[model samples]
Target: MTTTIRSVETFRLRVPRDNGAPTERFRAAPRVRSIYPTADELLLVRIATDDHVGWGEALAPASPEAPGALIDEVFAPFLVGVDIAAGARPLTRRLQQTGRERGHLSGIQADAIAAVDIALWDLFGQVTALPVKTLLGGANVDAVPVYMSEVNGASAHAKAATAALLYERGMERFKVHLVGPPEIALAEYDVVRSEVGTSRLALDAHWVHGAGDARRLARGLDERGAWFLEAPLAPEDVDGHVRLAAYSGTSIAIGEAMRHRFEFAQWAGAGAMAIAQPDLGRTGITEAISIATIMGAHHIPLAPHHSMASGIAYAAALHVSAAVDDLLAVEWGPRIAERSDSFLDVAFLEPIGTSGAWIEGGVVAVPAGAGLGIHVDEEAVRRLAAG
Candidate 1:
């Protein structure tokens, strides 16, 4: 069945989570507040073929409406009548060309392009009857390791409670997002470590600290015997990262803001980060696989980042991690598990023994079956869109 790209339809699907309650930490960031009231804010992209339909979602901006606008106003027009077989490269090239004169690649445009790239890959997977991981070159290991990401909250207790629940669910490896002052953040980590033990803990500063602060915090985390310290300094401060990475005993993890393989090459060659954390949604499969190769040459491990985007992004990350020989683990957010499953058709084959959660052994088995090996619940997506 030869499939011709008919038209690309983009829309916003807002499904409510927690009965419109403000239970999640990052939900109130003003940009995502409306989504809190609505439950879910997904940017949906539909790729139609003569005999099949493919669906994809964007990571969406903090703003409830930006993702949809990005797709409809910018991406959809450029992609509507294109050939899907050309794959993501052509679409990405067009996006780069359109944004070339804009001087930066860090806003709605990147997000929109990412959405289209993901949808195209899903379409490609469906067309070929192969999982995306196999399409990217198959897996070194059947499953990728998973590290639980923290829930944003005001208090250490709240964060600790969330961590404890995940621990009980069988996740031995964990990373917490530190939002407050350095001391406060340290205390939060201490509490979590006390509960989950030091060996399983890692801290993500989210580029929140300066060089000096990052150096100090990295040292502190090392003293606690934590596995690694992630994105402690600002994204562009390569020198700062190099210096901190040099002085700190804990391994440094960075690279989610980096969009292409060259940026990752620079960081990996410079020995700036011990673990490279590229986002599949932001980098797409092409650049991500390239980045993984570059990291492999330097003996650095690739640990792809997965945020609150839809399952497509998560599946894309899984595929990349599965293909990389030097992959360590993939990051997973519990919030996504709690809220996104209903809208996705084939959920991430639960990790084995976590009771509806990705298995806790740190390794996630590559999904089997065709095309991302998952399906979208179109009805549920449409319901959210209607709301």
Candidate 2:
């Protein structure tokens, strides 16, 4: 009995705005211009075998210039009519291997592969009647710690206020997204650190700075007491990161934009990153676990990244975080945390501690249920899918 990939449905979920107001934090006031009109464009793939249905979401940018189109037009066609249970790993390997020659690491192809990979895992879990963490080697904890990710809003003051609010809500770890010059980022970091008060303040430079600039900014941040500096240089700048990590007391965190476990292996082997932040959406559970294992071998902590695509991605991250031995707290976007309940009809999973620190006294837990252990609100997915 083979589990067949019956069909693939690709659709866009535009979180509608009321009266042109920001529908969510990603779209809220003093718009950053770069992150607005946020939409949850996903490719929902349904695989069936023996009365079992497995759902997967491929989250892509709303813009045509981006990679979502590749997932819809290119990847979906390859996945149709295949047996998911038996063929998923082979298909993923083939897709990745084929993509390597074409230099297709990021974009629609990656997103599409990720969607199918995740769906296959979900299907596998459902078929086995086991949660993903159990499949990965059982749960290590009950819930994973979460850090509040800052929105790229217009005003620094408003963003700082938002950070403070999250801190008040039991978030100990906070990260401010850096989109501009080092000085501008430094100032914003200062505001948030002052607001949150020197606990676990991290800055994600988003690969916007060069080595020299990163060094200068990192030195300044070290003085101000930042826990880590993330993606200060471009993803390809492994040497730059290694140098920055060596020079600054701030731990260098990378790997979100990077795909594949081997990429993380190289980074970890080279001591390029002190923290390995892999997005399960991009790497999938299999590859993410591989990355985490590699990072664990190097004694590096795995901190998965989360965003506002669906609960699937978040659940996937949680499962992975629970299984990894050297797991650090995962990144949780407050934007998603605030609106996840409204978007999806499920209990707010777990309270990421106040002030952005997820691991209280150095311990975190994973959510327990069946499959990913998250109850997906099919109604919400349907409503967003309808729109």
Instruction: Put down candidate 2 lDDT per residue, 172-278, tens digits, no spaces.
Output: 77778866677887887777677776558888776777777888899888888788888788778888888887898888888777767778888888878899988
Clash count list over all predictions: 16, 20
TM-scores of the candidates in the order shown:
0.87, 0.83
lDDT, candidate 1, equals: 0.73
Model 1 TM-score on a 0 to 1 scale: 0.87
Candidate 2: stretches off by over 4 Å? 17-40, 62-91, 94-100, 104-106, 151-153, 337-343, 349-365, 377-383
Worst 10 residues of 1 by lDDT: 28-37
Runs of candidate 1 exceeding 4 Å displacement: 19-40, 103-106, 151-154, 354-360
Best of the candidates, TM-score: 1
RMSD of each: 3.6, 4.2
Residue 16 lDDT (model 2)? 41
